[model samples]
Target: MRSFFDPRQLAHAPSREFHNGGWSAYAEVPARAEAILAAIGGTERPADHGETPIARVHAAAYLDYLKTAPARWLADGREGDVIGYTWPAVRRRPLRLDRIDALAGWYSIDAATPLTADSWTSAYWSVQSGLSALDAVLAGDRAAFALCRPPGHHAGADYCGGYCHLNTAAIVAQAARDGGVARVAILDIDYHHGNGTQDIFWTRGDVFYASIHADPATDYPFYWGHADEAGEGEGAGTTLNLPLAQGTTLAPFRAAQARALDAIAAFGVEIVVVSFGADTWEGDPISAFRLRTPDYAILAGDIAARGLPCVVLMEGGYAVSALGANVASFLDGF
Candidate 1:
């Protein structure tokens, strides 16, 4: 299996994040990527696919904000990472706002994602890594992995949140469709639900999105990911969400995976995009799943047994010390 990783992804490190009504050290850090790289051995630097693929999923205004927010914050005589403190509750209307704070609020979904000077650079490269992996799969590789940090799955077409700035999985899926793949399926196995990914493809039938994550009723990103959110418009019945309870073990988790895989098979997709996250490991610091390191291999092997080309994109997993082993085990299955 070919794997891609860009060193520039580590440059987007932020000092801290706001969680549970308090400020704390950021759970998503550069060390997370380093650990994975150390375990995985060598990785190729991703080729630059430019901004066209990213723009296919993310909004132009949001991309501009990500690129310029840090400079704008500095120009306002502010220091540290730029974080949004206020957010609009109603529909946003056009307005002339020059303040960086206002722009932050306008473009952000929550305060967990902070914008640093190199965040845009890192995020841009992160997308390239996923695109590079997709390139490998499209070229006839059975599977490929993209080690993306500042893990994306929470960022939508126009907003950043959940320590995610850009929806890399969504972008790759769209790119697959644009590259002539008739049907694509995104299977997100992160501990947390991929709300942004679902939102981006909510009304599209070409790419089916499925996720098995902690129940939103008691976990992060508590709005989407319920079982009832099947899809809307042309995308109806294309989305499958299986919300597991906290402290879920492998038996039930495997059941959920079976259901998701069965649906994807039924959809008859030509390719499968696995939004793989090691946070579901039992030792993960910020997650609730109780899956052990060995369990990942078994779970991933199940997906591999489906005999489909796979493009695996890294997402959330904060147990720094155990992360590498968990990831390696997962890859071993494929």
Candidate 2:
């Protein structure tokens, strides 16, 4: 499998993230990409597809805020990392905000993702990595891997959260749709629910999304990801959420994976984009699943055996020591 990555993804390293009632060293770090790259062997920097592909999925206003918020915050003489302090409690969205501070809060969904000076550049390249992998698969490669940093499964079309600035998986899925794939299914196996991808394709039937993750009742993003959220309008029955209980084991995890795969197959999707995350491992610092290193191979083999062109995009994984082996094992099995 050809892997796409960019070392520049290390530029927007966040020092801290709000967790467990206080701030702690961010779980998402630059070392993540480094470890994955080391284990995965040679990788090519993604071709520069620019912001257009990202804009296909994310809102322009959100992109503008993400791109300029860090520089504007520093220019205003703020201290430490640029983090959102408050978020609107109601569902009524704010139309516009001119102040940088208010804009930060308006565009952000939580305090976990902090913007640094290089955030935009890093996020830009992350999107490029996913896009380039999509390009490779479209160009006839059976499978490709995109090692995206600042994992993107959490960020919504208009909000950034959980260390994700742009929804890279959604971007790739959207790019696949635009590239003439009639039905594209995104399989997000991240530990957390891909609420952002769900939100983006909530009303569209063309792109199907299936995520197997910790139930929202006990997970980080405390909303969405419920089994009943089976899409809205035209997308009804297209979005599938297989939410697992906390401390889930490999047996049930595989069962849930089988169900998700069955649903994707029923959808008759032409391509599958997997939002792969190693955080589901038992030793991961931030998640509660008990998938072992070998379990990843089982998962990857199942996906590969489906006989479909696949694009695996990196999502979240923080067990730094074993992260490399987990990623390498999955690709090797694939």
Candidate 3:
């Protein structure tokens, strides 16, 4: 299978993240991509598809904030990477805020995702990697992988969080629609729910979103990813959330994947965009799933059984040591 990645993806290196009411080393680091590349052998650098394709899913203002916020923060005498402390949780009214702190809070969902100077560049190329992988699938490859770093699944149209700046899966699905795919389904097998991807297509019927992740009641991004939050209006029944328990094992995880695949088949999707995350590994530090390394092949083989063309975009997986083998196992299975 052809794979796409950019060296620039390593540039969005944030120093640390605020987690559990304390500051800690950033879990999402450039070494994550380095480990995957070393295991995957070679990858093609993606061409710059520019902001047009990204604009299909993300808001222009949000994009602008990601691009300029670093410079604005530095100009305002702020030190280190930009992290937001406040958010408009009450009545998020539309208003113009020029302060870097306010803009950071306005455009961010949490304090975990810090914005560095090269964040926009890396995030831009991350989307381009997915687009190029989609190009391969459109050109008749059975499947392709986008080794996107600074994993992007938790980002919404207007906010960035969960170590994600751009919603790569959402952008890729929208791009597939623009490329003439009649129906598309996104299967996010990440440890955490893809709240951003679900939010992006919640009211749209063109793309179907499905995810199997840790139950939001006890996991990160605790507000979204419930069983009852189905799509509304034209996208009704197009969204599926199969939130598993915290120490979930392969048997139940595999069953959830089968149900997600069956739902995709029923939706008549022509292509599947997998938001693959190896963080579900039993040894992962931040995540709490019990999936072992070999189990990835079994899970991936289930997706392969469907026979639909797939464009797999990288998502979260912080166990740097085992990330390579886990990713390799999934690709080998597919």
Residue 66, model 1, lDDT: 90
Candidate 3, which segments miss by more than 4 Å at Cα? Answer: none
On TM-score, the stronger of 1 and 3 is 3
Runs in model 2 deviating more than 4 A are: none
Colliding residue pairs in candidate 1: none
What tens digits encode model 2's per-residue C-alpha lDDT throughout 3-40? 99988999988889888889899888899889988888
Q: What is the lDDT of residue 329 in candidate 2?
A: 88
Best by TM-score: 3
Q: What is the lDDT of residue 282 in candidate 2?
A: 94
| Displacement of the residue 13 alpha carbon in candidate 2, Å | 0.8
Ranking by lDDT: 3, 1, 2
- How well does model 2 score by local distance difference test? 0.90
Kindly indicate the candidate among 2 and 3 with the higher TM-score: 3
Clashes in candidate 1: how many?
Answer: 0
